[model samples]
Target chain A: MAESRHLGDIILKIDHISLSFGGIKALVDISFQVRRGEFLAIIGPNGAGKSSMLNVINGVYHPQTGTVTYKGETRHHMPPHRAAELGIGRTFQNIALFKGMTVLDNIKTGRSLKIKPNFLMNAIWFGPARREELEHRRKVEEIIDFLRLEDIRRTPVGMLPYGLQKRVELGRALAAEPDLLLLDEPMAGMNIEEKQAMCRFALDVNDEFGTTVVLIEHDMGVVMDISDRVVVLDYGRKIADGTPDEVRQNPEVIKAYLGVGH
Target chain B: MIYRETGQYKSNYGADEQIFPIRQDRIGVMIILALAYLVVPFIGNDYWFSAILIPFLVLSLAAIGLNLLTGYAGQLSLGSAGFMAVGAFAAYNFMLRIEGMPFLLGFILAGLSAAAVGIVFGLPSLRVKGFYLAAATLASQFFIEWVLTKFPWFTNYSASGVITAQKMVLFGYAFDTPVSRYVLTLVIVTLLALVAKNLVRTRTGRDWMAIRDMDVAAEVIGIPMLKTKLLAFAISSFYLGVAGALWAYCYLGTVEPQAFELTRSFQLLFIIIIGGMGTIVGAFFGAAFIVFFPIFLNLFTSTVFAGQLDPGMLSHLEQFVFGSLIIFFLIVEPLGLARLWQLGKQKLRLWPFPH
Candidate 1:
């Protein structure tokens, strides 16, 4: 699996992050770094705190003990919306598309952060708002083309198949043109063919756009095939962190998988 | 075949983003506008102008206002009448107090004033949702009405909290006759509806629909929930306020608390329900049904009875028929008459093909 690893300077670093709900601990003293333009996968059994790691990275879940550094600035608590503004986009573990909206509109919402039209301008739909809207529409159309979603462009997300809905969610995140994309179980409910398509798109997104992607999933095959690096957690603690080969051979990840299957 | 739009192709985003992109739709709207501006006022008499057309136009405005909030934003509100009352009284006061205040400007300020009140009432929606939010809005509606009734300054101490609406004179021309008023109402409603139709396609409008479909996901996508929700409230009230001004000045010729009561609030809520929620054309359908169906029923009943039935009993019969029709519509086409209209258009788009 040796290829041109597009790893550059470390763009995002999480240091000793710990999150908890009341007496329940979600993550315990976890640390990881994602290099620029590389696919990083977080994998573990159920309740291994893999999803929590993604949440903490994007500030959706505040850690009880940790700091997140992006680019150069280290902030103790950057709000999730602020992360979005800083070019960090994300998808939920469960698909969360606007059920009533068409596929194109879902993707267009991604460009909303970049387009800054005042309320008055938006109400009138002229001047700055019109221009900005046209500009964002072009960007969204590009994403729709890349994702091969031209057929379902006008279909409501609710009526689409589960697999296509996931693609639309990915298209939405890509529409943001984010520097860092966070994906949570994107291929969770997909079949073998669907999983292969998703894995291909994920790679294409990273390669074509040079977007830094951090994905959390239980599918070791997809992880090994697509990820440049892998992080293994067990019982809310980071057990192993290394290249795909290194993580696959790690005794701890094997032991943890054998002990509890999820 | 005559209304076919198969050859039209949009080449740019500007063309694609138009409210009516299909060639047939654009031509249809243009023709409708021409009729409204050039033909209706010439033929319509007094009853047709005031009792039917004017109220229908104003109710459509109010229905659009509620649709933006309750339909698009997914925030239930029962205080629409209260907001309308605030608009009526506020506009009345602006005309009474402001020196040389232009009629249109006075109405605009009144709309802003209603928006301010709407924002206050909408604050509770931040914490509560669903049924609780409706209760909060109902409270605002009642509270605003009570305040307007209790304070003499609002009505200028007129008998029974009633203030006669001032003449709407813009650009040195007084719109006094039913024809002039009808034209004025038609122009105002058309302009506002056009603006509203465009607004829902914009970024802010998408934010509202996002909130409606799913609020948590909306927030995760960087949509500021507070700002978007409040803007929905403000803009919705602005439309309602303008409608209120029109309802008073152009239609009723007086501002009275009795006209904008709880029943009127429910009537507006019904308009969105029976017309179709979330579509601009739905508001007009809902308003027309609410306004004309009863009048038609009364005329039929009198003709059948040969003018023998008592007037009170005839009124009750009209009420019974109206109530049953609303129930039938809600049961048979919960999506509303507008959805029916849309289905018809879709059929026409593929007329030769059965599909």
Candidate 2:
């Protein structure tokens, strides 16, 4: 497991990040770094602070204690919108698609960040607004094609199957064209085939765009198969962080996974 | 075959993004507009034009405004009547205070005034949501109505708390004639509806919908919730305000503070709920239901049981029918007439082919 020593190149540095809800500590002094163009999996038992870590990274929960440095900039109390504006995109553990909107429209919503046409132009239906809308639509269609959602492009996301809905969520996150993508349990409820398709899409996204991915996954097989590194958490602390092989062999991770005293 | 889009090629983005991409819809809209402008005035009598058409058009405009806020933006507001009162009172003050003020200018100023009031009232939405926010809007409704009734200055120190509108002229022609008033209202309603339709298709409209759907997710996605929600309030109030001015100046010609009351807000809310909440066309549908149904009911009651049924009985019957209809529509199709229209289209698309 010596190859575990080189866990890609570090891209996101989380330093002493801690979060608490009144008396309960969700995450306590947890720190981790994700490498550029790397797939980092965060896995833990329920209430083990895995999701809290993702929330801190995406600015959903502001960490009370340390700084999150992304691309060498120290992020302090930055809001989710600011994080999104700085090329950070994320999907929720629960599906967060605009339910009433069509797949195309939902994906198009992700491109809202890229659209800079002024209100006057949009109000008047002028040249620049029309051009920008068309351009953005073209890009969205490309995403639709990439995600193989062409048939259901005009169908409402609410009516789609859960698996396709998850894919659409991924398409939506990808629509933002973020440098760092966060997926909160992308394959939580999926069957094996759906999981495979989602993993392939994740790999393609990483390989094609060279984007950094931080995923919270419970499926160890999927995590070990795709993740360049895996960070194991237990009781609001980072119990282990290394290559999948090293984390798999770590005695503490085994005890946490098995629920037995070492 | 009647509603087909075959052979209709959109070569560019402009063509594709046109408000009505289907040529038939555009052509149908043009024909309807022409009919509204040219034909309605010629056929309608004075009572129809003055008592029915003008009021219907004005109320329809107000309903459209409320629908934009309550339906599209997902912000339930009970202050529509108050906003309308603001428009009416503001327009009155503007007209009476300023010498040689144009009739159009009074309406414009009134709309702006309503927008200001609406923004102030909408502040509570940032801290509250759903039923709580709705209850807060009720405060706007009560407060504005109280001001309109209490302040003698609003009614120009009149003891009766009523104001009569002066004769209105746009350019050279007076809107004194019923035909001219009807035509003017038709034109204004058409223009405003077009503007509203276009508004919902843009960034601001999308922002409103985003906030409506899920404010938390919208904020995370970089939509400024406060700004977007406030813009919805302002625009919606502006439309309601203008409609209010038109209601007073053109339709009533004499107005009292009691004219825009809590009952008026309920009427508008019912119109939207019965019409279809989020769809633009639902405003007109709801308005027509609220306005014409009552008239039709009265006429039918008087005609069918002339001198047989008591007046109170007839009123009771009307109320029962109205309440039942609202409940029936809500239960059967909560999406309103818009869903029915979509269903009809879908049926037509699959015509001659059985499942």
Candidate 3:
């Protein structure tokens, strides 16, 4: 296969996005641009609207204030399915693998957006549908190989250990073949070894696929290491947005991480 | 060792995706089916055919329907009996209203009618889940039974709200005899169950399981929740509807509205729970347990404990034992007897090695 081209030329621009839950504001006038193929990290403390930002990008929770423009197209309150169709894939902050399903099946669920054949063809188990299924299965097998989950691919996700389950979740999201991937706390519950393995996989995904990634993480070290740019969120507002070195030295981000100066 | 899969390797997708991936399982199923079709007809007695086999087969089909909704889809329903009632009544109506309608067609049409009603009740599932959704299905149970009983039209204005079956002939073969009725029910149930098994392997089935696991994630992944869930209800009700027709036409030879009450739904639910939720074979296990346990208890009470206990006490004891068994099964192994069987097989596969 030809080397995939860099996605950095594309831009995901969030323009003055504001989302409110009932009467309270969850995100207020937040705006940021994520260049394609860039590993962007959103860092914030508890209740800093980090998850809400990811949710807005994936069309989970639509913003009330401003439109989101992706690839120069203005998108206002599109459904999650449309977002998925538009090449946006995301993993939940809390692991959300289909527990009763095998790791393979859960990954196959990610391919749902791409499959076009109707139920009749599927029910009869022949023709175009069966061929499509086999094609997808090959792709899923490749993913399983990439993730080194060959042994556990047939095991139900619920039975897997938490760290492996997290990997399976990533595998599922990757199955969508999205242009932009949103990962919410990929290293949340992992130990040092698992975290390193995850960081390596995440980097490989970006390098190999040239896919743009936006991650929400609390680990500043991991963020500084992998992220091309870091966005700091505080109280539903953008506090700082710059290169890792620039954001680390910024007084506002320092104060947000550690309490204000004595 | 006959069940071992050693030396069998799947080299392609077709081999890997076969319904019975293990060659032994495939052979075993074929052998059992051969026995059922070829041998059982000649050797099986009349009493076994009429009292045990026929009712068991019908109830098993009903259990399979309930399992699809409650077990696989995680949609708790208390309206199995109501859907079955719709099938029986609809079949009856089709027979009475349409001139020269075949019995088989009437049963199929009855199932379709029940599916229509099941979809209507399934609408509430979109807004609710768990116990609340279960309560909503109760509305279906009550409403269907009430309508069937109160409305004179359903029973053809029969004096007692009872619908009796006329002699049902399929291609001039009368299903009046126990053997013929058993064969008909067996054929229909086996075919439908096979369809149900295949249905669960399709995208629709996966979509339902995804919804059961997490609706939000399923929807986010682009599964149309409404379509998948409603299809489950429709298909499940269709099965129950067919089973209902069989119960009335083949088993009872007549049916009343009271035949499909809330208690019947509860019985079906219990069967799925104790048999193993989500496994097709579990439906049969559950049905057999539910259908035979009472009869076994009655016989044991009348014969073995005849001198030791009074008849009234034995009846009460039977109820207590049944209730206790359900509670015991739920508490000890919520996965039910199916899991136990699986565990036994696993141990056999790995004999002499500690798991």
Q: For model 1, what share of native contacts is present?
A: 0.63
- lDDT of each residue in B207-228, candidate 1, tens digit only: 8999899776677678888888
The prediction achieving the highest DockQ against the true structure is: 1
After superposing candidate 1 on the true structure, give the runs of residues whose Cα lies further than 4 Å from its correct spot: A1-3, A260-262, B305-313
TM-score of each candidate structure, all chains considered together:
0.97, 0.96, 0.95
Clashing residue pairs found in predicted model 1: none
Instruction: Give the TM-score (vs. native) of candidate 2.
Output: 0.96
Q: By summed lDDT, which 10 consecutive residues of candidate 3 chain B come out lowest? A: B346-355
Q: Model 3, B107-172: lDDT tens per residue?
A: 999999999999999999999999999999999999999999999999999999899986798787
Cα lDDT tens digits, model 3, A22-96, are 987888898889888888899988999999998898788989989888878888876887788788888998998
The candidates, ranked best first by TM-score, are: 1, 2, 3
Write the number of the candidate with greater DockQ, choosing between 1 and 2: 1
lDDT by residue for model 2 over B25-58, one digit each (tens)? 8898899888888888899899999999899999
